[model samples]
Target chain A: MPTVTLSLGKDSYDVHVMNGALDRLGDLVHRSRLTGHAAIVTDTTVVRHYGERARLALEEAGYTTSLHVVDAGEQSKSLATVETLASELVKAGVDRSGFIVALGGGVVGDLAGFTASIHYRGIPFVQVPTTIMAQVDSSVGGKTAVNIPAGKNLVGSFHQPRLVVVDPLTLTTLPARVIREGMAEMVKHAAIRDAAMLYDIRALAEETELGFTLSTIERLPDLIARNIAIKARVVEEDEKETKDVRAFLNFGHTLGHGIEAAVPYGELLHGEVVSLGMRAALFLSEKYAGLSAHASEDVLSTLKALELPLVLPEGIDPATALEKTLTDKKFQAGMIRFVLLGALGQPTISDDITIDDLKEALALLQRPA
Target chain B: MPTVTLSLGKDSYDVHVMNGALDRLGDLVHRSRLTGHAAIVTDTTVVRHYGERARLALEEAGYTTSLHVVDAGEQSKSLATVETLASELVKAGVDRSGFIVALGGGVVGDLAGFTASIHYRGIPFVQVPTTIMAQVDSSVGGKTAVNIPAGKNLVGSFHQPRLVVVDPLTLTTLPARVIREGMAEMVKHAAIRDAAMLYDIRALAEETELGFTLSTIERLPDLIARNIAIKARVVEEDEKETKDVRAFLNFGHTLGHGIEAAVPYGELLHGEVVSLGMRAALFLSEKYAGLSAHASEDVLSTLKALELPLVLPEGIDPATALEKTLTDKKFQAGMIRFVLLGALGQPTISDDITIDDLKEALALLQRPA
Candidate 1:
């Protein structure tokens, strides 16, 4: 099987990026010596799709796998969910020596990983991401969390998984819009780390826009693998996001999180808001970091071709967005720590984005011609 | 100020065992470069005692502090309390970069540390242990937890603190019975790691039994400091309890925890049960570990002189105690992994104990003649 290894010293693990990595999930877990009864956490929607396959894979590989299914959406990412899941883990006899498998999208991965981090002071967990959003972005990083009434992921831990099984074949099951959502992150990866990779990603997005075929299947795994490589590299260098090096990956996230908070939960997908946020960030990048208009539009058009929004969703209030940005944990010590592109491949951590700058970022959210 | 530096590599920290270290709480935080506000987590009873002094110390040292008080008992050590305290932390505006101060006994430290470990994926926490139980045992190691209905410390993490301020003066405020409870751990440390320290501990126990005076004050701090060093050494060698060297620290905890479980909550203090558990373990030690009766009696006499129980509670059932021990997380792989004393200063990890051995241990829990 194909894999990308993240070198985080003791916390290091491999991301198996393939067309059907989930089929080999049990072997991967057993190889890591994480063999025992498995308490698998997923969502209702994911259970219907790939749940039986995940259970059988582990069972065939010599594990007593127990499945705990939660609701499908982000609203299900709550402390209440974690509490109930912890009970299920205990009842299922998943000891500290056993492993937990997160078998779904971002919500499942986040809830399962966060639960694993605190259960019996944390046991090992394996990520079997069945969504493009989870495979490309959330699965690789050790950022597991659940939402509280006050905010999203206000409570969590950086509990790294023993292994991550990423199968791009899962993408065929996702909605077309959801596939585009995952593409936004791939564009962000190119914007911050490698400008050359942007060309390959844009071509892939164009193909997805038209339709899937034999070519899409052949190319999708490679696209997911490259995205995982970029993410794995960043996470290796800065595991905790302590310094600016890792913060660069937050290129479109400051405004993205702001726009996400401005609207009601589930109104706009994470990648859609991020796509629009990147447009605003690029506009600021031109003014603050001397990034060229050509490079900026090049990034924006790929998002557009994927049918992602280049502006904030209709009925979103700019003032509310600014207020939510202020409350963001990223806004440390009365400063908005924004990540902007310096050039095609140079990402800058900027603290100079004032209220006026935020207003300007909001202004750039107007629909493009 | 006196300090015992635990050399745990990345998880290394200093355990400051002194009289007036609480006054330097801010200096310690500042020295660690943990600048900014601190959220002080404590119990309602402790808030009335040292809360103002603690708040004032940080305030005078140019740090903002928010105090969160929970109900003062084992009952408060629940996920519900954690949920409420988490909300309080968010309300207090504590962010990732900010710090948390656990200021009270074991319950406060465990609750606050567990909260910090998961709050925003964990923030740096400072432990200001006000009880002897906290200073010598719970606060020294990074073993943070809260009780579930299932068991004590069934849900938790291995989150080490930024600094541990173990002010010995706090023992002065504790009830004489509480002070005796702390001595139980000191005896366990001596039983496993130092036979010579046992003599000193026995002498100290006699003094506490007789009366308290200036001699106690002058000598108690030094005794507490030595206990801290012994604990620090064990934790340094084994941070996560992955090896049996750390398992040595659980010498009497198997039966102790079982005894605690058999009794109603709040019936027997932790150290009291541990004292009784040590007696039962000593009986098992002689059989399975080849320990001499002389060493057994010597340890038993010290506990007896200190007024700790050599027998189980009057109405306790041996079968129930054995059943509770079976449910312990430590009873892994269908074996009762118990730590028994082989000799003075030599503890043995014995997994060969059968049901018959357990019955023998229960039979030995009779009051000394």
Candidate 2:
């Protein structure tokens, strides 16, 4: 598959998606014009799978490497983890010229990318996302962060990575639920910017149902690249999330992040909550953005085909979710800038999203259609 | 006094150096176009002195204000303080639209500016520097940081402030030693960029001896503004410290910071060490950069006029200091990249400095010329 280049002038970088790209990670990163030492920040679980391969590839390419593995869970995404990783990198003699390789899912990517952002007042880093969610969303943009007690990603910088290498082969090792998490972001991309990509996503969903090996699917790499292209375009338009164009990427995240926080930490994964959030947003889109009911159904059905949840979970409270949106980072200055679609593939940020409208949206998510 | 506008295109900001600016800090910041709430992050000492005045000014300017005070001194420049400040801001309803007023010296500026940099992925911050060290140096460049156990300023970002309000009146409360700490940087700026500024510094030193009130001197504001202008010009050339142009500002810091770590904290003030370091750098400048001995003597005489030490301390180990330089952030890729001077005001970066030369410089500092 061809590489997707995210154009941000001086901060521009490429996202490479291929079947066997993981083994060629060093060469791709080298092509990005980074040299010298490489700090490979991965989690224990991922280190067991591909750590040696990654280190060996970099070492072979004349780049010295050190592997620093954290615990394999969301628990490791904290300021403490960042401090520990920074100490380890310093101990390993990593300097300003060195680059970090975030070689895991979103947790490792966020942790390592953020570490790179502050280490020596910012250094270069490459993203080698091993999960679908990270491959399609987190690794493509410059948003690197760790969860704080206040909220997720509250302490971070917009530090763009030097490169991104996505290997579809890594998805074969993931469970169905994890794969579905990444599909949620893909569906978001289709809903926000590319209605035509929904057709490709639906076809991929069918291939999953047919039990085809994920890496063997002919269009898997291309589909990931397409999602990255959408992300790249949005980021290019507004790299700092200052403009509404980038805020449109929060199509499902505004309510989704709120619902995620309202519940217990591990009760629901990020993408699952986003799936539910998307349903509520679809309802709002029809009412507010003049989105057609048929267009909303097409997106909902596509999400359904990917085995994502459309209804709110039983233990979650609608009132708590609505209140939590007020604390969401997207909740700017008491205004819930809700992202509504004019149609499938057309997103618009709504400044008039009242608390009552949010209540109505959350209330609609209580039961199936 | 007129404002010194440090122009870096979109990141340009004015450095106001009037004696009474602190009383009008809110108006200055408001002129910078920051609105909503203002979180004034100060220290216990500064708050006791001017916190109420600052708060009242901002409130009078139509900004709801909150005061968050940390323990005074450098011990508070830690990651723990950052985490605490972040939670406090979140609790105080300080959001993206709100700005932070760093209302003390370098410590408060760094802590609050760093907090602002990461708060909501960064927000506008105004610098209300109460000490000469901050007003002339730290506040102008937007180099915000907190010290780590590994190194001072090891983790930080180059988040520029929207405005810097430098009230020279604050220097009235500082002891002579505290005043001299800032003078070291003044001397450094003069040595690196403005040789004529040395004459003004010598005159200021005479005024300090002749019992003139610190804030009553007519040229005080212009002196501060001149230092800021030099710093602003260097930062404009290399905002991220990516070029050697910015490194020239570190003319005395290479050995100065290392020597600082070699000794116990608080034993020798920052400028004292830099004064000693400047003497050593002068030796090297004469040896390698062909800086005339007359020019070197001119700088040494200024340090003498300011009562800055030109000799190493009794207890500090030169070897340990040299070893600490290896860990300095400027020690990139095993090269020293020491900033040198070809003349009084012409600085250059030399990558050819060897360890033996550094040893000789340390040795030179062991005795007074």
Candidate 3:
């Protein structure tokens, strides 16, 4: 087991990575001292798959449990869904002393954690993330939010979970496309902070099957642990994202958020949009940020091999996407800031890009053979 | 001038008590390093009184200022009001870097602060509290919240203000009832933690016209400063109310909340209900928690002399009020916890009171001569 501790003073919690951390969740909850009735907020699909196991674990650990499942999709990550879940918790009389467990993908985790943050001004919650995207990124950080009509994560709170149980075994059941999508975020993490991890990810992408077998899962644990640690370290230093150190984590997110906003939410996964965004950021990095040309090519090749989208979707206007970038939370004083790759293992924020510059870069990426 | 520092690690801020802190708000905003556009969130009544002064101060501070005034009342503390203010801020293109100034009583402060917390996932806000309720208590603690139909402060965050600029001069125009209502919170602060402050408040209450005079106004700075310090120390040590240490601050709030919920919200000021609630809690503390009879009597005498309503309103059934107690956020598991005064300077949380016991205590406070 590889353990990562998010040392956020008194709010610190541990992220445990192992093969069957799900079954050991009762022990984790016990150790965290969260008692009373445990409410598990998940989705219908997740409940069908691993809900019984999760409930059994909590029951065995001497907790009275209840399950509340929403429809599984990106639509569930909305204010309406959060209000419904909070209302259910209130009707069921989940008080300050009760424990709320968010046991699903990023959508469920975000909505459930946000509900926990606002319910009774906040209560304790744990994360049992089953999706690879969640295990690698969203579950480790304390950023919980719901999508608004204006944008994704427009309303939310920075409420950390009491414990995060990342079981590699859960990902064995994920679809190939989902696995490919999850790899995009891991790849972005590597390209921005760790070149060696990027190399390892590239090597993994060359394999016939993306999901690792039992023997190869050892390599998988360290990579996931390392990426999560980088994020945790950044969050520890700047939990509120006020400083530049934490902003580096947004290396691909500037364009990624725009792409995600442009595309119908459920049509493409977050990591897929992010993968394509990384390519655009790399192009801008080379053109405007003075990044090495070879390193940008390496990032492109690695993403291509993983079957992740490096090009913008068909019929979407680059100008429309660029317009969306202006409203981004990171944009300040009429300047749209971009986190561009300085090298394979480094990134920098740049504000010197013009609309013409972005159009030229988009043409380079979308050029016909 | 008296200044008290509320230290919560990185969220630390100063509560500046002076005669003209309102006029000097620009200097304070500059010193606090707040840049970008300033959106001042106040109510129509406060705007009619001091809004121009606040806007001028922000404008002089080199900020592009916008004023948003909502209808003034406790009803304005709803989610709809919060959304309205949030919409205006967004329409004005307020970004994460922009600063929000909450420039009214608890209603405006709570609504504005809650909106700021949810806006862009969190932004910095400063509190320029004009009311006595805001100056002494609400503005000092980082407990920013908006009321939901289910409960007060149901949706909120512990988002600390960058600075709290309290001008005692602002109180010169306040209604006598409003001042009395504000003093209830100040007296509660003293009753729970500081006997010396409680004695000082008792001395003031015994004076003619309840001590509202120029000399008394001169003494306002120290009184407000001391009350803020008491709250700051408690909130600093326990930012999130995980322990009994922070619960002490809710000394009169348990029953006060029940009263607020039971009565029409705007019918009685929060302090009036709190005064009645404190008397009920004192009665329960003496009978159930073994609180010293002499100490409880002294406390009751001081509250009575202040002309605070120690008696519950007519036609209110103790049993019905006890029912509201169960829904309080402070209640955990099957127990409804009450913050009781063990003595003038000592407060403790008690869970021993049954519905019948609470009913009996309520009856004691409600019985007419």
lDDT of each: 0.85, 0.88, 0.81
lDDT of 2 at B59: 88
The sequence of per-residue lDDT tens digits that candidate 3 reaches over residues B35-125 is: 8889999998999888999999888878888999999887888666765676678778787879799999999898888878878778889
Query: How good is the docking of model 2, as DockQ?
Result: 0.70
lDDT of 3: 0.81
Model 3 chain A: ten consecutive residues of lowest lDDT: A360-369
Candidate 1: stretches off by over 4 Å: A209-211, B366-369
Distance from true position, residue B154, model 2, in Å? 0.9
Model 2 lDDT per residue over A1-369, tens place:
679998888998989999889889878888889987999999999998899999998888889999999999998988788878888888888988898999999999999998898888889999999998999999988998877777778888899999999998888878888888789999999999889888888878877865656444567888889889999999999999888899899888888998998989888889999998999899999998999999999999999999898888898899899888888777767777889999887789888788888899898888885
DockQ comparisons of all candidates to the true complex: 0.64, 0.70, 0.44
Report RMSD for candidate 2: 1.6
Write the number of the candidate with greater lDDT, choosing between 2 and 3. 2
lDDT of 2 by residue, B1-369 (tens): 768888888988988888788888878778878888999999999998899999998988889999999999998887788888888888888878888999998889998988888887888899999988898899988888877767788778888999888888888878887887789999999999899989989988877865556444567888888898999899988898877898898888999988988989888888888898888899998899999999999999999998988877798799999999778878988888888999988999998789999999999888877
Candidate 1: residue B4 Cα off by (Å): 0.9
Give me the displacement of residue A355 in model 3, in angstroms.
3.6
- lDDT (tens digit, per residue) of candidate 1 on B152-229: 787799999989987777777788888888788888988988878778877777787656766877777778888888
Cα deviation of A86 in candidate 2 (Å)? Answer: 1.4
